[model samples]
Target: MCCNENFEERNKGEKITTTLDLTEISGMNFFDPHVHMTSRTTDDYQAMADAGIVALIEPAFWLGQPRTGIDSFIDYYSSLIGWERFRSSQFGIKHYCTIGLNSREANNEKLAEQVMEILPSFIFKEGVVGIGEIGFDDQTAAEEKYYRLQLELAKEAGLPVQIHTPHRDKKKGTQRSMDIAIEHGLDPKMIIVDHNNEETVKEVLDRGFWAAFTIYPFTKMGNERMVEVVKQYGPERIMINSAADWGISDPLAIPKTAVLMKRSGISLADIELVTYRNAISAFAQSGQIDEHDFIKIKDIDQSQKFASNSILRGGQQPRIDKNSIIIS
Candidate 1:
């Protein structure tokens, strides 16, 4: 009998069954190399912490709508490095960010020009990891112009880049995205080509770029397909992310994928590399990350404040019982 079958037979009369429990993957540290915490809430952070997510990098992307002025970009970038960082720390997860002009916003040439000027100011800030979420959205000339400019900025700043592949014509766009980065004379290892699928994965890995998969529900790559990708191609430069944002998405996708991958027979070591270590190794190029720091026990002190902002609300005290049934 199979291991699962044997276990089920042993517990025949009990309520136990062969179904895999997600908790089986607990206590394993995870680092989501790409996620948008600015669009998320405090509850997500707490859940991520509970799920073994040690650190995450939130790349700058379109905020579901276009902003009309340069000041909006400035304030948005400020919050990434300021309030967002503070909020994540309250939940004991380290938050790092990438600053860039997203492709959708880049089409506004008038505003894109001004936004480019200010990117330099935030790119080198503390906790800022790289230039990212900065590739083709609609594959327009304006998008290409800013994408190339940001690539140059990333090269100039000696930082890694996170490329967002176009959802439509993804295969062609993925190829072009790699070509441009190579044309700029940037090393493939320094670039992370994200939002990949079966068609784009082999080429990305073959080209020596870090291939990041966004496990989104009902769209993008699903968990079952992700397992097949791992089964076909061993985890080397491959990494998985939640890429959870303001839309309908699961913040715990990484941990949940870990569960599925485990059930699908992917080894623990391989799972760890794809879900955590690979992301750390890729972004550690920024020289900002210390893996040791993440491995330590990160204690959360709710009393801490940043710019007068706390995780608590309106003078409410911190709840001590996470499992309490009472809702106040």
Candidate 2:
């Protein structure tokens, strides 16, 4: 939380420390439109708040290991909209999620079919944002099949689509993701292309889709490059996210990058546009997000329980810190 503090983190489950300074962007709060809090911990929630993250979007994604049954999917989806929402609320962080059968998971045709049947049941729930983190992984035929199907679901439901472009051949995959969405008659405004890089940002922006960049420390899309992306493109429909998970990732990447962007001469308004406003604007189409909800913090009671479960443990006193957070 201080300048160049050695913050302990996990890199592929290995403990290590990454220096983070929330100094520059302390009072400037942000919104990470894509992060996997289910794969994170309470410590992360605390640090995120300290790092100025006020709201976030968790997209239902690949759980690393493949899930065999629909029950796992159901419970996982429910947790994001229920327990995760509750946990984030305890921290005064507004949480919203996108539900979908991921690209890799879509390859399991039988399970994918079952998932599609259950999608409608959860997509309309409270804190539910839209159909997302759902696009191409390997860009397989099966991935395409469900991708188109989910686009139809999003269109019919009048919700936004958060797309995950493939790790390999991302250009073709990103183009295809947009192409299919258009072919399905989805407006570009309703589609958010995530995990974007230098290669695909122009087309994504030029075509009118929200281009989201995920900032990581060592690889993928790092913060330095992100600053240049904003410098060249300007922050119109562009957004930034942490995309933090159980692996080697920084949960505070958005604010950390904000600090770097500020030092690199990006104006505060441009920084907020990419780090906050743009994300909310892209997803607000769902009617689930309200600026007033997380725009400012009020008192948060750790004693409050969701389904008789509080963040408190045995004999632990509930704290009414308006700026604290916890997740089990």
* TM-score, one value per model: 0.87, 0.87
Q: Residues 1-328, candidate 1: write the lDDT tens digits.
A: 0012355666568675474346988789899988999888777888788888989999988888899999999999999999888777767788899899999999999999999999999999987888998999899999999999999999999999999999889999999999999999999999999999999999999999999999987668899999999999999999999999987687899999999999999999999999999998899998888876564325334333345656543222253555598777
Per-residue lDDT, model 1, residue 57, is 96
Candidate 2, which segments miss by more than 4 Å at Cα?
1-19, 295-297, 300-328
Model 1 TM: 0.87
lDDT of 2 at 256: 84
Evaluated at residue 148, the lDDT of candidate 1 is 99
Per candidate, the number of residue pairs that clash is 0, 0
**Displacement of the residue 290 alpha carbon in candidate 1, Å:** 1.2
